[model samples]
Target: MGTEKKEIVGMIRGCIKTVTCGQKLDLNHKSQNDVVKPLYTKLAYVLGLRVSPFHRRQGIGFKLVKMMEEWFRQNGAEYSYIATENDNQASVNLFTGKCGYSEFRTPSILVNPVYAHRVNVSRRVTVIKLEPVDAETLYRIRFSTTEFFPRDIDSVLNNKLSLGTFVAVPRGSCYGSGSGSWPGSAKFLEYPPESWAVLSVWNCKDSFLLEVRGASRLRRVVAKTTRVVDKTLPFLKLPSIPSVFEPFGLHFMYGIGGEGPRAVKMVKSLCAHAHNLAKAGGCGVVAAEVAGEDPLRRGIPHWKVLSCDEDLWCIKRLGDDYSDGVVGDWTKSPPGVSIFVDPREF
Candidate 1:
């Protein structure tokens, strides 16, 4: 077997930048680079598309995307997708207009910094660390309501950097205000299930790092001032700037779900759990990408509007089977299609 990393795009004239290239994705494994994108089956993922500064306005990018799509089909991939920030119109046009791809889903990636103090200080329910097998069971119970849900549960639970899985269980059999029961917790009395909320964490410190550089000195000054203010008023929730010298501790939280009032409490407890884990591991942030329409998205803590980052998911399907069991319609345009946000894609 060939061990060489495949390279499709040649180096630009006197420059090291590759014109374009992508990778074959398998959801059963973690990304070699740790950006948490997961697919249900095999697919082609276009990544790190770049053109030299001297190579502007040419058809090279379009050609590269087309060739990569062909490579996907030839390799038995049923679909291909690319993820990019929503503001990048140039890349968007190249994929949707030139390469026959369409807008599939727009999801937001949210980041929450873990401080020494607990952000989710819920006292009613206690979070219990779960074994992988039990965690998979809890995930499946909540999976049906989600789109783009991971098909391989083991990949998520057993990934090398996975910290742990957790469930929020009532502190005691009898529930009360002191017991941490909320109005929504009553639903479980009528229709009982194993637990209230479920969540898992992945450590992406080695697989990922964030970069933030200001174009001008004024912006840098303003950022520094904000950091100073954040320290002065610890509860201000200012965004943390990425340090060039230090890789931010990044842990990804995924498969988050809960029912009703208990769900809210669970979200808090789970976040607290994640924060404690991140703190112990020297991680600075815990993040997750979720569908904008998902109610759970509203629960995960973030810096109001500032911490919400949107990314466009573009997909092109190659097969004709759009039966009930299958995921999406190959015949229709990508917009308005149901999407499952895999946290691994963060």
Candidate 2:
């Protein structure tokens, strides 16, 4: 029995790489170089190769990456990609020039104040808390907008975590007046107790005002009906529904990141609504992650670049037959694109 247990342990150890950390390594005896390798799994990401500084410019980097690509292909990665800073010329050259990886997507992080005062008073819109029954209506509006992931609506109904979702109905519409104006022209205003505090206060106030305004008669009717249902159906014991005046959060995965007119309009409405919610919710800050370049930084001079970090780029070769493609405007092609979100989130 002891011998059998030892054998099992040895086999398990051999099957998995021994490591102080989770990262993998490639040993090149021919070149006498140690290459830090990226391991690819169906669920895990494959990171890019990092050559030792001492072995720099010796073609080791290329060799190591090729090996990693092979590993990815064998593990069945549908696609692989790499990311580098816009300023890092050498790394960029190696990937695009030598390794033949094309530009996939650019991601940036943007923040907005939740307070009314931080936002331009002229562009302010209203935000409201939603009830469970409102989920279907919100879903329809979101789908019509074509601005979010398809699964988002389902996820909402299923009761996910602290994720706050809301709808931006314009003031006169059946949904009510949502945040108006584009965020591109709007500037991020800074306040004391940090910016987030001010934004939260603003959201709470804005939500209260919208509720008092009776901006949408249909919404008011719905609210009253919902109340009647709650009182009559004692067994239901439903959760407290969010009123129209409460501000909420928005998460945009794809549609609003670009620079086209539609993208701008969507972002504008989103920001306006987000600001209103922030004020009404009395939440201090509203946050958004923008891809490509920092539009607010580039467009608005006063907005500062807070922090930037590169996500790890990993790839493994799934098959020997794979080819990235003949270059020249690969973004138009289907396989030419790659989408990445945090593994934990996915």
Candidate 3:
């Protein structure tokens, strides 16, 4: 929003521009030889483009996107990206049909209830909190294992809202694995696992307060009443699922990374740990965003599927040289491109 000043607004008659650069994003890192190479390109993110309803259908959207593309080109940006809901036809058409952008990826933003449902915690894995300097260890471990991991490790570790960084590994295996268990006891690393995971918790109560909508009056009343009882009568353990009424108090996990066959198990352990932290902080839910095909999406225990909680990612190339290996044509991008979404950018 800081980019919305007078000169740029006057040029577009009422448009805004936001450009971000100087971060390296990994496109494809999966290799048989254990050598991970990155795409190494600068990204320009264009968001908050709006055209008043009174000025609709007058090629305003097309002109706005064109201006941003030109600006990105002049500023040495190789890629331009945007995100929106999958069902937004108007915005979709403006980007794909007019702006020459390609449908790059569709990622699932999973949300988990902190206390309502059961979370299966792993006994073999132990999650421990780390100091700010230990954040470098997390970056190195994940970068060696997971693909599409962001290169901006310092920003995540030093963010104002970052609670801490945590790593999940086999218990009692001090090869950088720390001690302590959540909710119960654990055993030593006897089984020589294949993978590990690292996660960072970002308190989102001040940022991501959901506003429940489209519920009947009676339903809203029932949801609130049930929540009150659930809080009061802990022994009864009544099913107080979140609905369109309770919308605040959330903690989000970013930089979810994992590898190997047992990667999903490590992810589950981290989810349980993050959930407990959120509950202690008086939060209602825990959430994260993962690419639709990433194992972390299947690894983390999330809300039931088909919950209308997914986002559409679209990208366009600003530079003429397509040597970056990004599928220039949207139709040509099979199975979608691998992506990493930095929560700080949101």
Candidate 4:
């Protein structure tokens, strides 16, 4: 966990002070997105804040966030997000409570095998494991059809801190419908042994969307791919069927955009598909991290409340020399955020 340090500064009563920002960077060992794209560059998602209690209530927190916003903006960040627990009153108050940041979506950081039996077996969708080359087309389709987090595809692809990357394609489509499939398949990039983080990027259908209006040619392509993965990786756990309010599930992580009628439906279908994989594999859970201000939260209030844990939302200025400041105790091992999906499956 090498600390990638950045700086953030604040003004209190007209006096300037600085804070240190750091994050642990790694590759998503299970990422499904990296199968097709070449690596580029990306910033780390973790940011820490160290502020003094004596300086509390001086609007320093707001200043810190503003500074970080400016830094990301200047660095070509399309959008940046932070995570925190639902019950941490201070953190909750600071972000949505006081900082005026809106709630995005609620996602569970679920643990697997804890409640494997609770998973409903009837809601399975097919998932296909795609060769890196075939998966790239799905990646392009995901990019063209939706607005993804981190905004830039290159940055998301290039980031060192990711899990495994994988892609889901339709069962029979030679190519996606949006663009005719290109010749030549992508090969999986080999990583060094002992890599803890795996990046898995998947080109999946908006299952929830398909159930509503009807599946498109492109959607069918993704569905087919998902079917294949489900058959191959029986060890992964899946999310449950979504209701009207909780109409979406963890599948939104591969959503085209944050939220829409189509996006919601796509996510729903994805949940069904993932569930099938878990059942076949006998896996227990899945996890998803959602921004506090994500629009997807409009329907699922429980997810919003549960996702908040002990994680603090901290910000600092760039290029300011400073030591690490502490906002809240991160060492206490606050209540673990409960992810609805099994970790083993991811």
Top TM-score prediction, candidate number: 3
Best by lDDT: 3
lDDT string, candidate 3, 1-346, tens digits: 4775543331232111222221233436564544434444556667568777767788877888788778777777667777888999998888888888888767887887666534446878877676766665546443422333455666667888889887677665553344333321112122324666778898888776776678788888887788777777866756565553556678888877766677778888998889878878778778888778776777776776413356887887666553345534333445522344566655
lDDT of each: 0.61, 0.36, 0.65, 0.34
Report the lDDT tens digits of candidate 1 across residue range 1-346: 8798864443211101111111223456665763322223454567657876566578888766667766666666666778888889998988888888888777778877666433545666766676676666655544533455556666668777778887676666333224344323224334544446767888888687765544477766665566566657767654554232345668888877777655766676788788778767777677777767666676677654435566788877755442123444542533322244454555
TM-score of each: 0.71, 0.39, 0.75, 0.35
Candidate 1 RMSD to the real structure: 10.2
User: For model 1, what is the error of residue 119's alpha carbon versus the real structure, in angstroms, after optimal superposition?
Assistant: 3.6
Candidate 4 segments exceeding 4 Å error: 1-46, 50-60, 73-81, 96-100, 104-111, 114-127, 131-134, 149-151, 154-285, 289-346
In terms of lDDT, the poorest run of 10 residues in model 4 is 190-199
Query: What local lDDT does model 1 show for residue 87?
Result: 86
Regions more than 4 Å wrong, model 3:
1-34, 116-123, 144-148, 175-194, 235-239, 243-249, 305-310, 321-338
Instruction: Output the lDDT of residue 148, model 2.
Output: 14
Task: Rank all candidate structures by their lDDT, best first, as comma-separated numbers.
Answer: 3, 1, 2, 4
Please give, for residues 110-199, the per-residue lDDT of candidate 2 as tens digits.
Answer: 444332333432232233444434443433332222211222333334343323443332344332343332121112111101101001
Model 4: how far residue 205 lies from native, Å: 27
Candidate 1 structure, TM-score to reference: 0.71
TM-score of 2: 0.39
Please give the lDDT score at residue 220 for candidate 4.
56
